[model samples]
Target chain A: MSESDLEEMFTLAVSVAKEAGQIIRDAFDKEKEVDTKLSAADLVTESDQAVEKIVNTRIMEKFPTHRFIGEETTSESGEKHELTDDPTWIIDPIDGTTNFVNRIQEVSFSLGIMVNKKTVIGVVYAPIKDEMFTARLGKGAYLNGMKLQASKITDLKQAVIITEGGSSRDAKEVEDKVKNIHALITHTRGIRAYGSAAVNLCHVAAGRGQGYVEYGIHIWDFIAGALIAKEAGAVVLDPTGCDLDPLRRRILCACSPEVAKGLSQILTHLDMGCD
Target chain B: MSESDLEEMFTLAVSVAKEAGQIIRDAFDKEKEVDTKLSAADLVTESDQAVEKIVNTRIMEKFPTHRFIGEETTSESGEKHELTDDPTWIIDPIDGTTNFVNRIQEVSFSLGIMVNKKTVIGVVYAPIKDEMFTARLGKGAYLNGMKLQASKITDLKQAVIITEGGSSRDAKEVEDKVKNIHALITHTRGIRAYGSAAVNLCHVAAGRGQGYVEYGIHIWDFIAGALIAKEAGAVVLDPTGCDLDPLRRRILCACSPEVAKGLSQILTHLDMGCD
Candidate 1:
């Protein structure tokens, strides 16, 4: 895609993200009628569905030809889905739904555009903090109007890494992720989990942290952030240190090339079960 | 202290916190002339000292008989430290100095008052986020304008725990903490590190997480937060599972009585090498 094409996608993604953010903000403080899916910890509310409906409809009405993928619809429609080769819009209406449901104010909307099965533009907006993070394929990343880059710290021992424990769907995998985390903590700098993949990836892009690793996030959770981190000069890979497949969700991201290499070495030394 | 007396301390603490916050905020984006103590990370700056000076002077002028302890001044005067029997103020000009120096926006000013060596009134304010967390011995805890309480999560497997990987001064303890964390991940729900003890403790008070643990934090870091969490109906202890000595710095906190018991049991089971 040309620079102008990526720029256009960025503009559209930002607008869509803002629109979705407004939906979330509107439902922020009202009495929440909650529904549990897996258990008490894993929950959903009317606001989550309401926000997703607003985002999906806005994007489809404006770009009917573009393919669409969203979290809520996917959960209802079924799994084994794939993004088409045509221009596709991947969206997470309210990333950090737990935080939103609990009124923690760390939720956001993530929107990404994929062309030829590769992400080319991305945008993430957290309305509560009034923070917007955006990027194009070659254009650098920006946060709140300031140009952003990953950190200069190249040593794994000095880096701050973020990772999630597990997904609600896979309790066993969550346990496995925790074990891998055990092995990684001894060799890495530090660990954090912010409960939002989109925000975590943006923080990696902005040099707030050196890297992020998560076992099982959905495509919508990472599509925008993986592109943003790549555009901001970071290495996006799997936990096993392979190139990131845009269609896949499980990911490992490092702020710089050297830190990526160091992280790989540390993981190898620890004998972590990663693929 | 009476209700009105406690209110007076809170008001004073709030005023001092805002004053120091402005000083830190003004220096946040500018070129920092850091004075590195040991390495680049062990940093101090004129801004920190200035803020401490402003706070200490304000406290002294208002209550001349009250004692004051601040990071910059304590490190400067090289004085023998003691928590006297009289009322004393403990202050951390900037709790997460590394975060502040790195522009991570996770740092804050911490002010705690110990009456007869027991924390009775505490206040922590993150000027960047404009969040003021306050607590009196029995008056209850609050964040911003709302009342606060620790999470109601009773099951250890459903809890989100926060902890820190310690500084270089305590490398062996840092490694031990990692091993303890390794044991924790396999059994608990999730883990997070936000780089600031005050912020992490405040999150617990707001019911955002189940607990927090750390090693070698000073009285200034844990004193304010201890009272806040206690006021929120949580339990505070040392790693040994005993009620923490108020004058001491190290801390282990949990949301509810049952959760705290479960956590203390796990720490004992894992044989975490803490003193």
Candidate 2:
């Protein structure tokens, strides 16, 4: 894609994020029609579907030939998304739907654009908190227009890690994740869980925390925030210290490589398989 | 104390919190001189001591006869506070010092006034986030002047819980807390950790999460938040379902009694001895 083409898409992505954020903000305090998928912790609200539909429509209308992959669409189809060399827009319209349903303030809309199977642009907007994080592949990330930079802390002992108890109810998966959580607490200064994968990544980008690691998330849950974090000079990788596989159901992000490596060694990495 | 006295103290408490908040916000993004108290995870920054000193001086100036207990003072003196029937003000000048040092947004100034050994006024101010939570005995809680209420969820399986990996690095303490965390993740819809006991309690009061439980916190850490949660119609109790002993160093807060009971049944309660 040319620079002008990417700029146009980025503009569209930001505008669509604002629209989705408005929907999320307006419905944040209202009674939500919430449904479950996979497990009780896995939530989908009316706002999720509504925003996804509106965003998907707007994307297709402007870039008719562009491929689109969205959390709701994939869940509805019950199929794996096949990536291609062509420009593709990936979205998790409401990244923290459970937070939205529970009236927590970490909810956001995540969007990432990829060409040649590599991310080129990213945007994440948390409507309740009024934070809009944006990034281009070469340009630095920004939070509400202020440039963001990850923390300079390099030691695991000085780091505060963000993690999650994902919606997976599988006993073994839960146990493995629990082991990782224990390791995090034992090794780091502390651990925090904000219940949103996208926001967790953004937190690392904004230097709110030193690192974030999670298992059992879809590509849409982190694709955008991964780019944003990377643009802010953070390291994004698989939990095993390898390059992040977007389709893989896990990620390890840190402000520096030493902390990333430290996290990888300590975590009981769960092989959650691929998308 | 009379109603007029309580009101006067409440005014002073709120004002002191704002001043402490100003101190916190000014130093939040700056380089911090961090120190460790109990362990590597137990952090104390210069801002913590500075805020505590300022708040203590302000409180004593306004109410010279009232007794005062603060986190920094207790830590510095290495002495336990004695709860009494006289008017007392308890403060955690920087409730989440670790977060403050790490530039996380969960840090706050927490203050509570107790008369006849009963709390009458509570205030928590998160300077970075600009959330002012306040409550008075027999009065409802408010966040930034808007009335607050806990969630109505009653079932553990349908609820989200807030917890923490506290600053304790004791091996047994870590194991026991991790076990409780496993139980929480197994039973609840989800779990979140924002790294601040006062903010965690206020989260439940504000309906951000259905419940919050933690072991090994002092009266200063939770005194104000406990009252805020109670005033917002939440159940504040010991982890074992008994009355909350302000000095007990453990607390369990839930939006409803049923959820509190359910959490109590599932938790592997830790007997973190009194302050």
Candidate 3:
């Protein structure tokens, strides 16, 4: 895509995020014990679907031949993503669904535009906290119009790492994650769990913490935030120190290469498989 | 103490919190990985001591007969507190010290007043977040003057719980806390850790999450927030299902009695000695 096209897409992405954020904000206020009833599950799905459909339609209308992928759409159709060298818009209508359902303030709407299988524009809007993080492929990141830079801590023991107990109940998955948590606490100054992959990446990018790692997240959950973090001078890597495979369902991000390598060494890398 | 006296004390407490918050906010921005150097340790301790001395002096100037207890004073003097029937002011110059050193956004200044051993006024100010949480004995809690209330969820399965790994790195203590974390993930919808006991309680008060429980925290870290959570219609208790002892170093707070009981029933309670 041309620079003008990228800028236009970025503008649309930001506007679409605000619209999705409004729906998320409204639904967040209404979330409750409805998590117990299967029928009432639509309470969240309804808003998710509404946002996804609107976003898909907007993308189709603006760029007639562009591809679109969304969390709600993928879940609804159970279709595998077809990433190609085409202009594709990937979005997570609501990244922290549990936080949304629980009324926590870390929820966000994340959008990333990938062309030639490389992200060109990334945006992660945390509406409740009013933090709009944005970045272009090589440009630096920004939060609410201010430039962002990751903390310059290179020592792992001096770092405060952000992580999560993701919503997987598989016994082995739970055990592996718990082991990683133990390692994080034992090695670092502390461990924090904000319960959202996108928000966690944003926190690292904003210098709120030095590093963040997680297992069992989707491409739609961290793709945009990963770009933002990278643009903020942070390293985004696979947990095993390999190149980041977005479909791999795990990520490790840190302010410096040393911290990133240290984290990868300590973590019991879980193979959560590809998207 | 008379109602008028309580009101005056509450006013002083809030004003003192703000003054202390200014210092904390300024210091938080300059915080770094100073944990590695004994000299750099003074970076945080200086702010803590300055805030404590200023608050102590103000209390003495206004209410000479009132007793005072503070985290910095206790740590400096290495003396046990002398709790009595006399009206006493308890304060933590800076809660979440780990977060403070790491430049995370969970640090706060907490103050609570107890007369005849019963808390009458409470205030917790998170400077970085600019959240002022306050409460009186019977009146409801408020966050920045907006009325606050905990979530109304009763079932553990539908609730999201807030907790922390804390600063303790003892082998057994770490093991116990990790065990409780595992149980929390298995039973609740999710778990969140914001890294500050005071902020965690305020979060519960604002209906941001359903419950918050932590061990190995001092009274100054929780007295104010406990009152805030209680005034917001939440249940505050000892982890073992007893009335909360202010001097105890552990706390368990839930939005409902049912949720509290459910949480108490499934965990390895740690005995982090009293104040």
Candidate 4:
């Protein structure tokens, strides 16, 4: 996408995100009726649906031709959708649904645009904190109107990282995430679990945390923030060292190139499963 | 321990914390010559020393004969000092030193006052984020002048938790922390790792996250924030279900009492090491 096209998309994303955030915030203030999906650990709330509906409506009204994907609507069908050959809009109205439902206030709106199967424009905004993160391919990233940059933390010992495992109830899945934790504990300065992939990636982009890794996250949860981190001069990689599968995505690490390479190598050495 | 006395002590703690935060911020913006202790992951920076020096000078001058326990000077001697009566002051000049050294911006100044060897006043200040958390015995906790309270998350599956495991080099220790995570993931809404104990506990107190659990942290890392969380009506417990230790503490959880009990039970049922 051209720079002007990216700018327009980002502007539209910011607007949609704000509109969705207002809906989420309104639902958050009202007493929420919480429900679980698959298991108790996997939470879904009325606010999530309410916010997603708003975002979806906004996008559909503005760009009827664009391919749109949303977590609440699309993921249930469990079908793979390609981000290639056209501009595809990916939306996560409430990326941190648990945070939203519990009124923890770290929830965010994550929106990304993919051109030719690659993320080219992205915006992730945390309205509660009033922090906005935006990026376009080759245009650099910005957080709250200032250009973002990763830290010059070269050594693992000096790097502070954000990490989390899946919310899956399967013991083996939990064990896999634990194995990654086991590999990282002594190798890095410290690990932070901020509970939201989108915000955690924004933190890495803003130099608030050196890196972030999570297993089994959807594309909507990461595409926007990962693009922002990448444009901010941080490296974004699949923890498995393979190209990220946008449709059936899982593990990811966004950090400075040095940290990303170091972490990827360690995860590789330990035979940790990222898929 | 009187309310008035606690308020006065809280004021002193806030003052000391702000001053210490300024000292650390000044060093952060200046040159950093970092040194390591236990390993590369254990960092001590000039900022840490400078903040400690400033806090110690101010407290000693104000209280004259108050006993002080600090991370820098005391831990440097490799001597473990127990908390004392006679109005003891517990200080972590820069908790989350790794974050400080890495320029991750989650570090904070933590101060806690113990009267009769029990925490009575607690303050934590993160200058970069401009977040100030303070509390006194029975006066309740406040963040940025707003009263703080734990979230009323009764169900474990609906809870959003934050935690971090220490160096995973020790397979046994890593396994123990993982066991806790294993149980938590199946029950909580999600898990987060925010890197700073002071900040994590404060987040819990502010109802940002339901709870925070961490392994292998010192008293200075959690003393003030734990007390603050307790004052906010959150239960602070060692994973073993014992009251959080006043000295050389490790493996702790801070959350609403019911949630804490539920989490403790889960960890126990899973036969984790803490129990």
Candidate 5:
């Protein structure tokens, strides 16, 4: 796609994200009615579905031939789930449903557009903070219209890391996360668990946090955020220090290459079963 | 103190907290120069000292004979740090200095007034969120102008809990916290670490979260927040299930009696060496 086309897609994504954020804010003001999805921790609310529908309809209306993948609706079957060379829009109407249901204010609306299997337009809107993050392919990332730059800290001892305890309560994963936390706390300046992958990624993109690592995340959770972080000069990678795989559920993002190398060394040495 | 006296103190606390919050916000805009006191994680900034001085001078000018204990200026020497049966003001100018320094948006200006060793007034101001939580003895807690209420969730399986990895990275404490997290993540709906005791307690008070636990915390960390939570009808206690000791460093707070009992039972069963 051309740069102008990417810019238009980025603009549309930001507007749709803002609209979805409004839906979420309005639903949060009323009494929340939540339902358990896969387990007690995997929650879904009417707002989630409603916001997804609105965002989907709006995007489809503008780009009728484009493929779409949303957390609330994964209607595609078989290999259609895999990213193809065709244009696709990925959306997470409410990235932190638990926080949204609990009115925790760390939730966000994330949207990303991929062309030829590469994210070319990305937007993540945090309504509570009224901060919007946006980026286009080959263009810089921005927060509320200001260009963003990641933090300069290189040492793990001085870096503040953000992560989360995922919805899974599987005994082994929980134990692994605990062990990872123990290791990180001993070496890092601080650890924060905001319960929202998109917000955590944005914090890294905005340079407020130096690093973020999490497992069992989905493409919709960090697709837009990862692009934004990358545009802001962060080094986004998988556990093995290669290019990030959107289909993969693990991520390690750092503001600087040195911090990324440092964290990668720790995780690689610990070997918490991501393989 | 009379009811009217408590009312006056509450108003004064709210106003002073806002002023301190402004000071903190201004200083946050400028380049921060941090100094370490106890450890690498135990950071203090010029904003902390400046805000505390402003709050202390304002309160002392209004109540000349009232005692003051601020995190920055602990004038009381020896055993005087113990809660006395006299009127005193407890303040934490910047409750989450790490968050403030990192620009994470969870920092707060916390202040509490006590009489006869009981907290009678509490005020916590989060400038980034523009939220102010306050409470007066027997008058109930509030966020902004709305009365606050703790979450009615009684089941640990459905309750969101908040905590922090304190400044102390002691091997034993880190191990204990990791163990507790492992145990709680298995039973609770979710866990959040906002890195601010005041914000975490306020989240519990406002019914956004159902529980909060932490160790190695100081009186300045939770003195204001505990009262706010208590006024919102939460059960605040130590691991021993007794009234929380303000001087003590451990706290377990739950929004409902049943949840408190359930958490207390779990902590008691683990007995991770708080004694």
Candidate 6:
């Protein structure tokens, strides 16, 4: 795609994301009716479905030939979807559904466009904070139109990291995650879990946090966020210190390359199982 | 003090908290020079000290005879200040100092007034989110002037828990915290670490979360938030299942009586070491 095409797509993604964010905000004050997905803890709400439908429809209307993948629909069948060479739009209409259902204001709407099997445009809108994070492949990332820069903290001891205990409640997975937390807590300044991968990634992009790592997350959860963080000068990669595979479920993002190396080293030694 | 006097103090506390919050907000966008206190990870910024001074001056100006305890000054001398029969104001001018230093928006200004050795008024102001949580004894909790209520989740499986890994990076403390996290992750709907004890407690009070647990925290870190949560109908206690002693460094707050009972049961079995 041409640079102008990518820019146009980025603009469209931001607008669509804001619209979806408004839907979420409107539904937030009402009573939430939650439904279970893979397990009792893995939740979905009517607002999730409603927002997904709206976002998917709007994107398809703009680019009828573009493929679309959304969390609420794709995860229902328990099948993992892949990004193809053709242009595709990935949407997590309501990232952090658990927080949304619980009436927490940390929820967000994330959207990304992948072309030639690479993310070319991304937008993550957090309505409650009225902060819009947007990025294009070559263009730098931005939060609310102001340019963003990742933190310069290179030492792990001064870094504040973000991670989450994912939807899985399996005893073994929980134990492994806790162990990883134990490993990092001693060396890092602090650990935070916002329960929203997209927001956490954006915070890292904005230099509010130094790093983020999580496993068993889906592509729709962090694709847009990864792009934003990458554009903001962060190193986004898999735990194995390789480029992220869109189909992979693990992510390690850090503000600086040194912090990324330290995190990767710790995670590799721990060798936690993939979901 | 009479009911009207307590009410007046509550009003004064809220105003002073907002003034302190403004000080924090004004300083937030500027350069932050962080200094360490108890440990390297335990940070203090110029903003923290400046805000504390403003809060202390404003409160003391109103009540000249009232005693005052602030995190920055009291902790510097390594003194565990007790809540006495005198009217004492407990202040954590910037509760999430690390977040403040890092430009994270989760910081807050916390103030609680103790009269007759009981918390008679409490206020927590999060400037970035523009949320102010306040409570008075025998009255109730309010978030931005609206009444607040804790969630009614009784079952552990449906509850969302909040916690923080404290400043201590001791091997034993890290292991115990991880174990506690592992134990709770299996039963709770989700686990969140906001890195700000005051914000976490207010979240539970607003029904955005169901429970909160932490260790090695100080009176200034939680005194205001505890009152807000308690007035919102939560049960705030120590790990030993007794009322929180201002000097005690452990806290376990739950939204409902049954959730508190369940959390207390689980925590008692784990028996994590105190800092």
- lDDT by residue for model 4 (B1-275), tens: 56776566667778888788777777775558988776657778877888888888887877787898888887678776765668888888888777777676777899888888788888999887889998877889999999988877776666788877653345566667777776777677778776678988998898877878777777788889988898887888876677766554554555656777777777732222210
Per-residue CA lDDT of model 1 for A209-274, tens digit only, reads 788877667788888988888888888986668787654557788987777776666653222231
| lDDT of all predictions | 0.75, 0.94, 0.87, 0.76, 0.83, 0.85
> Lowest-lDDT window of 10 residues in candidate 1 chain A?
A266-275
- Model 3, B46-87: lDDT tens per residue? 787789999999999999999999987787676766679999
Assess each model's interface with DockQ, reporting 2 decimals per model: 0.33, 0.91, 0.58, 0.61, 0.68, 0.77
Q: Rank the candidates by DockQ, best first.
A: 2, 6, 5, 4, 3, 1
Name model 5 segments beyond 4 Å from true.
Answer: A75-80, A268-275, B75-80, B268-275
TM-score of each: 0.85, 0.99, 0.96, 0.92, 0.94, 0.95
* Tens digits of lDDT, candidate 2, B81-103: 78999899999989988999999
> What digit string (tens of lDDT, one per residue) describes model 2 on residues A1-275?
78899999999999999999999999999998889999988989888899999999999999999999999988989997788999999999999888888889999999999999999999999999999999999899999999999999999999999999889888999999999999999999999999899999999999999999999999999999999999999999999998899998999999999999999999987888788
Residue pairs with backbone overlap in model 4: A192-B193, A193-B192, A193-B193, A193-B194, A194-B193
Error of 6 at B26 (Å): 2.4
Top lDDT: which candidate number? Answer: 2
lDDT of 3: 0.87
Return the lDDT, model 4, position A99: 77
Candidate achieving higher lDDT, 2 or 4: 2
Q: Model 4 residue B172 lDDT?
A: 65
Model 4 alpha-carbon drift over 4 Å, by segment = A1-6, A268-275, B1-8, B29-31, B167-171, B268-275
| Model 4, docking class | medium
Compute the lDDT of residue B228 as modeled in candidate 5.
92
* Clashing residue pairs found in predicted model 5: none
User: Which 10 consecutive positions of candidate 6 chain A have the poorest summed lDDT?
Assistant: A266-275
lDDT per residue (tens digit) for residues B78-184 in model 5: 24476778899999989999888877788999988889988888899998778999988788999998999988888888888887777777787778887777777
- Predicted model with the maximum TM-score: 2
TM-score, chain A, candidate 4 = 0.92
Worst 10 residues of 3 chain B by lDDT: B34-43
